[model samples]
Each structure stands twice: as structure tokens, then as C-alpha cells.
Target: MAATPEGYMSGFGNDFETEALPGALPVGQNSPQRCAYGLYAEQLSGSPFTAPRGLNERSWLYRLRPSVRHTGRFDKVDLPHWKSAPCIVEHDRPIGQYRWSPVPIPDASLTFVAGVRTMTTAGDVNTQTGMSTHLYFVTASMFDDYFYNADGELLIAPQQGALAFVTEFGRIGIAPGEICVIPRGVKFRVELVAGAARGYMCENYGAKFTLPNRGPIGANCLANARDFKTPVAAFEDREATSRMTVKWCGKFYACEIGHSPLDVVAWHGNYAPYKYDLRAFSPIGAILFDHPDPSIFSVLTAPSGEEGTANVDFVIFPERWQVAEHSFRPPWYHMNIMSEFMGLIYGQYDAKPQGFTPGAMSLHNCMLPHGPDAQAFARASQARLEPEKLTKTLAFMFETRFPQRLTDYAATLETLQEDYADCWAGLEKRFNGKP
Candidate 1:
């Protein structure tokens, strides 16, 4: 796909090289004392210097100015609805299972950063573990402003409208059913592509999101690396006053700059922003008898240092075939160790078919018993055994090992469905103990 100043290269975490102008990049070494275009050489590290080669992520940038000039005296900024973790007692409401209707966009104009409303937060932001879920209702773009979150990387999922992300690396255009991830400390601005946009952002404070291991399933299917699109180098040398907002240690700080932070004329690195089309995800599922675990649908996972236990797992349930004979095609009723924050991009989710409309969200914390509501259970139980196709649906989940605590804004939102648990009321005792 095309972008404002550059195009995209296909790969996930590859050491890519790009230059907006010829010979802007270094010939051999990363830093050659003097850059080709009279630019400054800088290194951006996403991981530690001693990190393993596979895990090490750093980029060399040739910019018009060093990043040292991109800041001023930071002042505290208040983002009332943007919350972080460790403050568990946001409200006194009892939490069993919760769901919300589509949140209405506000009447007041809101920029991308101002539009963020935290729904749930897990783990500790200061400790750099766990993640948070946010609903963004954007009425305006960040004009003459940029934002970078030192707390975590942002995984954006557009549910309603399109968005154009102009980052230090390059520009990315994403629409519904497409997702893009901006690294933790990358400076970027958001612009509305098709008017006001609404989306979900999973702020991952743990390890950066990476493709899950296929293991026994082998390496061929499910979110192939070749499908990921990373933008090429692009920049502007124009001078203008701008505002920079930094989210560090659960607080916001504002900085003033004289020029765009995205003035990287050329870059070579494996640490940059990338986008992926959810439609291109090759899903692997239960082929014959039983319903497979939701891990099969994981598109990306941020590990929490434990084997097979992720700080956050980005899972999607897209259009696919249901052919499991002698089994409940919908998800079975069972409590899980991991907390789940779910959202519907479009169409009907197979579990909670009604009330869970597009842009709606639900939360089932760790060990919370939740599955198909009575309607879905009954429908799947009585349906024919023939293979059926589920079309035009895209539902996703941010499953985490840590329990997600509801934020005050989310706990008392007008969109919160007070009687969401009532959907399971119709699930009468169907067990007569008959073999």
C-alpha cells in the first residue's frame, strides 16, 4: 500500500534499510563520523545493548538534527481518563463479568491522545509488566503535535474509521480490520484519514509483541512474517513549533520543540513500526472433532518471562469454517487462568451474539467463568453437523496473564451494560444425566 512520503516493505523485524534521498544512508558502518546528507547519526534502542541477537532491537537514523534538540522543560499534563495499573480500587462495583455497548463518540473535539479512555489495566507500569486496554474516540488529529509513550508499545486496532500514522520511521495508513504497532518510544502524529476514527489500543508494558511460536503446528500457517508491512524512510526538513507529550511512569509530561521529531532522512534497523492486515491472517483451527484452544488464534504475544505464559496475547476470531463434529462449535464454558478483554470490530461474535455489537467490548478477568450466552449455546447445540462458514466477522481479544482491573471511567461509563450477565440466565439445566 502507498503512504504520504514512502511505501512499505514486507517483513517482521527484519533489518531494513531505506533512504528518502540518494546516498543519505551510510555506506558500510552505522556511524561514519559525518553522515552523507550532512545529517546527524543517532541510535534508537528498543532493547538492551546486551540483549540476545534475536531479541536485540536498535535502529540507526540519519536525521537533520539529533534527538537532543527535541525537548524542553517538561510540565505535568493531566489526562483524566488515561489510567495506569497498581491502583486497583478505582470503584467499588463487584466484578464477575462485564460487557459494554458501543461507546458513543463525544461531542467535543478530541485528538488521538485526548480521546484515549482506559478500560482495564493489568500489572504495573513502573515495573514494565502487563498491559492496558483503551477505547479511542478521535474527532481530531494531532496537528503540530507528537506523542511517545515510554511506558509501553501501542498496538492499535481500528474498529470504525481509517487512520494515518506518520511516524519517525515512515507513514502507515490503516483501516478497519487492519492493525499497526508503534514501538514504545517512537515519535509520531495521528491524522484522520476518513474523518473521525474510533479504535482500540492495547498498551503493552511488558516485552514487545512478537509472533508466537508455531511449534508442533510448524512454521507455515497463522500470521506469516512475510505479510507484515513496515514503512520506509520519510521525513520533512521544515521548521515549525510543535508540542511533544511523553507518558512515563504512569504520568504525562509535555515538551516543546522547534521542528518535527520525525526528521529521519534515512534509517536502517529492525526496530521500527509495522502494520499487518487481519484479513491476511491464516487461521488454523479444529478440523475434525473438538474445539481448539483460543491460543490457536493468537496473532501476536508479549511474553512475561514465563514459558508459554504471555503478558498479553493479541488474538483474533475472523471469518473461518466450523466443522467440528460431535462438539460445541462455539467456545465452551470454562474459566481460564488468563484474563480476557474482548472487542468486536464488525459483524456478530460467535459467543455473545446479541448486545455485543460492533465497537463493543467485554471483560472476563482471570478465572471468570464466561463463554457463549444462552442464545449461542442453544443455536450451536441444535445446528446441523455440516461444515458451515462464518463470514464477515472480526472479533479480537487481548488475553493477559495478569488480572485486568477496571478503570473508574470504564467502570462507570454510560455504555456499560448493567444487565450483561442476564444473557446467561436463559441457560437452564439441560443435563438430565442421560448417557
Candidate 2:
């Protein structure tokens, strides 16, 4: 028996219970008692990570099982049109078909967001997808696998708990406030490493993100490439019953097996798990003149197929100085290749006037035309623009090619602050006589 290490014991002291469905789909029998760490060790040591192909065995650690009743909920909507062209899941076929469709969306041209469901059939399978800018919030404990886009870009932000992210590239124990970006197609798993981890998942289904165009601002302004760190080559192999779930084409399924699915013996690629501490972001802005477009603060961006068109742009406006002499403090009205879905990790966003709180998200479809609310515009226009640091606020935006649709669960979620729509109401417009 392997005894728990003294220091590491704290990490495992949480409420990690197991659901012993001895013979669930793919692998029919429950696997031997092994935590995610044990499985990682076995892979590091050279053992098959799956059950002997023919043997049927399975098990899952569903951390988010019981917390469905406590948290706030989204106001549900009805979006029947999305049922047909839903996304696809090509992994684990035997388990059965899966269903994923956005509950309802305000606009059809923007996005499609939905909860995920899956069943099992065969071996140790992990379903993965390269999704767009729609952030995911799992209402239930998702027994599944994860992967990055084809290029191996992984940027996952969890709202509630932590996840044991295992991959052929490397492994990371992540929680809220921290995010992981695995370049497209780097095989990985989403194991609930801690307590009921109910959180949001944002898939930027946009063009590959690149540095913001320097334009006249010159070089080394926004996001520096050196801040990005991709994982080096890593592999795992072990023979045991492990379940692999895959989400493809919009459905979820599973495959049974008797080996570790994270088996990448010797692979080399630029795509891998890399993260940038938002706090480390270098925020550059106008210290003397009017505030520039938020594009000046973009960290990474995925452009659309069209020139200068962005599929998704991961931009952040962290704590920074505000000293524009005759400028509007908040983000100015604008439209571009991207549809913006904004979230506040913590602190106030300069763009909106009010009601946009932490964890609250708002979407402005491409070309929809939006900007600072009335109250904010009035305040900034009247107040003296002295140099002052707007500290302790970290807001982010998922500017994508397609508009995002909210899940039925998300839209109808009682926790969905009904007052959000009223924020824009405060933005009073003043037309000049010249017009």
C-alpha cells in the first residue's frame, strides 16, 4: 500500500468521493483504487494506462455531483433552431450519442452555448474539442476528457473549483483565478481534483490569436511572446482500466480500455499547455491624451479568415493608470471583427457604467455598436483627468468570430442577475446641434 506523503496529504484531504458503477459502458468493471496522482506515477514509471483491451472495467470521480441546488442559475431560453447543426463529438463511439445545444440566444448570428451530456460504450476514452468563445459552466459533474484545438492552444478558466488536468504534454493542478491554455489537440483529461468544481468553460472558436497590431504604437507594447510558456515533451503509459470520454460534433461518448490514454512517447510541437499570469500582463495606454481602443491591451487574439478580422481576441484590462487629459475614462464605442463577451474576474471595467459585476458576462455582437454607459460618460467628461492607478480590477473579454448563445440552464439560471440589461439604460445620448 502506498502511504500518502505528509505534505501532499493536504491536497488530497478534500471531499473526493467515487461513484462505483463497476461496469459502466466502455470498461465494465471498476478500476483498482487509484487516485489521479497514482495514475500519473504509473505512467511516469512505464506501465500500461488502460485495462487489457478485452477486460471490462471503469470508475469515475464525480466531484460536482451534489452541489446543483446551492448556486445561482441562468434564465433559460428556447432555441430550437440550434438543435440541428449542433457541434459534433467524434470520440468514444460505443457508449452512445451525446447532445449539446444552446438553450436560447438573443441573436442567431452570434453564438451557440449549451450544457454537455455523455454516455459510455467501450474503452478508456477522453472526448475533446477545439471550441470557440462560448464559456462553459457545467451544472453537473462532467465525467469527461479534454483536448485543445488542432494547433494545441488551451486557455480554460474555472469559475468554482480546481481540476486535475492530465495530458501527454504535461499535468497541472489548477483552480479558480488560474487558467490553462493547451494548444489545439494536446490530449488531456478534466478530473475533478477537488470539491464539487462547478465553473465556466470558455471555448474561443475563433481564428488563431496573435499579438495586437502595433500600428503607430510601435513594438513591445501589449503581450510579449516570451511571457507564453509551452510545455515540453512528456509521455505516460500504464495498463489498467481507464475511461476516456470524447466530445465531438456536439455529442459525448466513451470507450473502454486497459491503459493510460496519455501515451505520447516522443512528440515534438510548438503547441502545448502554456499560461500567462494576467497580473504579469504589460498594460500600455495613453498617459497623456484620450483613452485608446481596448485593442491596445489585447494579450492574445484569434483572427477570422478575413484580413484583420478576429475570430476571438483574449483581451484583459487589469489595474493600470488613467491620466488621459480630455479623454473618456471608459472604453469608447466601437465595432470590429470580434463579437465581445466580457467577464469580470475582479474589479471594475472602464467600459460600462454599472451593474456588470464579478462573474457577470455581457455580449456585444460584431458591429452591434456599444460603448461607455451614460453615467460613466458623464462622470469622466466632468472629472479632472489626473494620473491615477485603477488598482485591483481584472476584467477579460472573449472577442470571437461568432456571437455566443447562452445555455438554457445559463439563461434561466435564477442567479442570472435580471438587472444586467438595465446597465445600458443609464447611457444617455447627447446629440450635438451640428449633427
lDDT of each: 0.92, 0.47
What residue runs in model 2 are displaced by over 4 Å at the alpha carbon? 1-131, 136-154, 175-177, 192-199, 205-207, 212-215, 335-337, 417-419, 427-435
Clashing pairs in 1: none
lDDT tens digits by residue: candidate 1, 200-317 = 9999999999999999999798899999999988897757899999999999999888888889989999999999999999988888899999999999999988899999999999
Q: Please write out the lDDT profile of model 2 over residues 1-435, one tens digit for every residue.
A: 111111111110121121112221112322345332232111121112473532211112211111121112322333322221123334332211112222221221221123321111111112321234334434333232333233224466655556656655445556666666654444565555554443334444333345567778676656666655433334343555644443333333445545555543222222235555567678888877877777777877655556765655678788888877777777776766456666677667666536666656666655666677677777777887678888878877766555444434334444455454455676655767775
| TM-score, structure 1 vs. true | 0.98
Return the lDDT, model 1, position 204.
97
TM-score of each: 0.98, 0.64
Number of backbone clashes in candidate 2 = 102
- Once model 1 is optimally superposed onto the true structure by TM-score, how far is the C-alpha of residue 342 displaced, in angstroms? 0.1
